[model samples]
Target: MITVFSLIAGMLLTGMNYLVYRQLIVSFLSKKTGLVCISVITICTVIYISGLRIVELPDFLYKTGAVCLGLSFMLFVITLFYMAGKWLFRQVSLPVNQRKRRFLSLCFKGAIVGAGAGYVSTGIYSGKSLPRISTIPIKIANLQRPLTIAQITDIHLGVFLQKDFLQAIVHLTNEQDPDLVVITGDIIDMPPEAIGDTLDPFGQLKTRYGVFCVPGNHEYYYGVNGILARLAQLGITILGNRTKQIAGINIAGVYDLAALQLQRGPFPNLEAALETRDPALPTVLLAHQPKFIEHVTPDHRIDLMISGHTHAGQIVPFSLLVLLDQPYLHGLYHHDSITRIYVSSGAGFWGPPFRCGAPAEIAVLQLTEEHRSASFLRK
Candidate 1:
């Protein structure tokens, strides 16, 4: 499945590069030169991205490849948008002679190149930075005292992120003095041997109710059992289609949709995960993908659901494409008028290191009866 998806993505990227070369690059240079430049760079980039999955690379090369792929995709998308806007303008404006048309075309091409370069450059710089903490207040009718849960998700721990980054995240989460910490999946993306003690930082988490984790698609790719065991050693509970009652809240967790598709374990049984619960107690479900909100029914009477998988598209125009699969790209949403689902932008990234428009976040959700439920994006 990974190979198939990679091939499809490779084809799409190839087509985009070709189009950019012909439509934009050709305006500045000879066709032969443009073709050579695009072809060489495109080939190298594809290799870099594909290499990330096949073999382990040096940190420098790995980061370089990741940035290369992100910059390529961003430039293509921005150029496409620019061309679209220009076409729309041409449709509305009067026709011009060949000379004027050529000049305008050249100007548009230059703008696309310049703007795309600047955008990608900025993305590379911003992507590696630490995320901000989004403090959200949620009211649960049954909660006795205020509860704070620090949600960490999609931290694809492998080549891109190491123990230092994980420690920093743990430090940040601990500073919040959360009651519970929930990992919404995509935790480990490499093999068990490769991971080693990189996740030891979790041992330092300072949560009262302890930590709970749900499997993301990336977990299945590496070694879910090993990864889960590592988390377990740190005194964290693994909730795979299971529920744990801590304090007065029923926290139920379901596996990601990838579990069913990959046939790694029993498909996500939302019913089983949610069954035999105290209906009176406000229920909080930890699901990896935000789309899991769709499985939630009004009869379930779930008060809140937390998820992080989309990475909020991780990049700009790319986020628009993420919408093709995900119902809500990011942020908090009121589903079914009874359940409030919050889809975090994820604490880490996937393949591409750079986050274009979507910033990484560690969401601190407060469940209390005092304040009305509200969310804010301060950063």
Candidate 2:
């Protein structure tokens, strides 16, 4: 199934690039040169989508491929729109000269190319920038005092996102002085060996309660057992369909539903995970995917659920496509009268190493008394 999907994605990207090259560049260049350029792009796309599975390539190649793919996709969309406009204008009678037509075409093509490059560059730069800290206060009954929890999710530390990025994020999170630090999922995308020095920074994370984590779908794709063991070694507790008590709060976590989707085993058992000492005490559930709320019941003891996985469509039009799958793309949403879920756009980027529409974020949730008015803090 993975192979089939990769094939389809590679073919689609190659076809789009080919169409863009034929429409925009072929007129200015020889037919033989255009074909060769398209062929090279097709081969590279195939190698990138599937060949990585068979053999490991340098980190630079992955970064280059991602940038190229993003740029090509943007160019393809621009060319398609231009073609449509040309067809529309052709329907009307218009006086034109060969040189003027060529000049206009060149100018429009140049503008689109410049705009596409700028978009891709800006997106990548945004992903690398420090994530803004967004503090939102929520009311939960049975809480003694306000509790602040800092959340970092989907920090896919691999290839483009390296150890330095992780370290910087950790530093920023520590500055918040949160009571608890939670990593929702997609903590790492590369294999253990490829992750070399990145794992140690997680150990540097400081919190009064502790650093808690739940498995994201990426963990399963990379290697669940190995990732869990490494996380344990880093002093981060792995909550696999289980509950833990911390700072007088009941925290429960379930494996990602992707485990079930991938047919891993009898995991992500929400019932077992929801087991709490005192039903009256406020409970928080750490679920990797937002859609997992479907398995929850209104009568359940959960007060707040934290999730990440949908980068809120990291890019523009792609963000729209994300809505087809994720229930809450980003931000806090009321799931029920007693239960609420906060979905982070993610602390980092996944693929393409770019973020166009959705800016990365670190969610700082302050649980206050129910009677307290809502408050938002930005830094």
Best by lDDT: 1
lDDT of 2 by residue, 220-300 (tens): 888877887788899999888888988767889999888888898437988888765467678999999999988888888
**How would you encode candidate 1's per-residue C-alpha lDDT over 116-177 as one tens digit per residue?**
77888777776788878998887677786789999999888777777898899999999999
Q: How many angstroms is residue 138 displaced in model 2 relative to the true structure, after the best TM-score fit?
A: 2.5
Give the clashing pairs for model 2. Answer: none
TM-score of each: 0.89, 0.88
Lowest lDDT 10-mer window, candidate 1?
Answer: 370-379
> How does candidate 2 fare on TM-score?
0.88
Clash numbers, per candidate:
0, 0
lDDT of 2: 0.81
Runs in model 2 with CA error above 4 Å? Answer: 27-34, 52-55, 84-111, 193-196, 370-379
Q: Where does candidate 1 stray beyond 4 Å?
A: 1-3, 29-33, 48-64, 85-114, 371-379
